[model samples]
Target: VVGYELSNGQRVSKDEGIQMAKIGEIAGVAVATRKGNEYLRSLPDENENNNLGNLPSITD
Candidate 1:
């Protein structure tokens, strides 16, 4: 999920994962950059879930 955001410092969220899945279904990497940016806008809060500390939020 954070693949693109790693170096760019964008971000990734659960919703983006969903969008990525849908976009990927129709085609691969098409408009993916935009989707990734959108995902970055709503990036997930690491502590939104169990608060395990540094744990990732499951999107799929």
Candidate 2:
């Protein structure tokens, strides 16, 4: 994205990685279904990484 911006290519890389992550989540779902039984860590959930519990978003 930065490179495109520099060259004025009109293509954006900004947040493209974020988009790829979503696509990756879909891939993970597919793989988990065909390979074997889904496990806790293999599943996606809101509470999956909430080990610290609800906390502040920005402390600074």
Candidate 3:
């Protein structure tokens, strides 16, 4: 995903969200690295219905 739309309607870039997550500004997600690229992953839980992949895309 290119970015995320916060609940307050603010759109933040992937890197920005990653930075926020690092400082505990965002919750329920953990920072991960793959092939030298940093990314975000939802914390493991029993809820299968709210995975990040399941969220609707913001086309704007």
Which one is best on TM-score? 3
- What digit string (tens of lDDT, one per residue) describes model 2 on residues 1-60? 121121223333424423443467222222222265321112345554532123223221
Name the weakest run of 10 consecutive residues (lDDT summed) in model 1. Answer: 24-33
TM-scores vs. true structure, each candidate: 0.24, 0.20, 0.87
Clashes of 3: 0
lDDT on C-alpha atoms for all candidate structures = 0.40, 0.30, 0.85
Best-matching candidate per lDDT: 3
Please write out the lDDT profile of model 3 over residues 1-60, one tens digit for every residue: 889876678899999999999999877788999999998888878986666776678997
Between which residue pairs do clashes occur in model 3? none
Cα deviation of 5, candidate 3, in Å = 1.2
Candidate 1's displacement at residue 25, Å, is 7.5
lDDT (Cα, 0-100) at 5 in candidate 2: 22
- Candidate 1 lDDT (Cα, whole model)? 0.40
Q: What is the C-alpha RMSD of each candidate to the true structure, in Å?
A: 11.5, 13.3, 1.1
Better-scoring candidate (TM-score), 1 or 3: 3
Return the lDDT, model 2, position 26. Answer: 23
| lDDT score for residue 34 of model 2 | 27
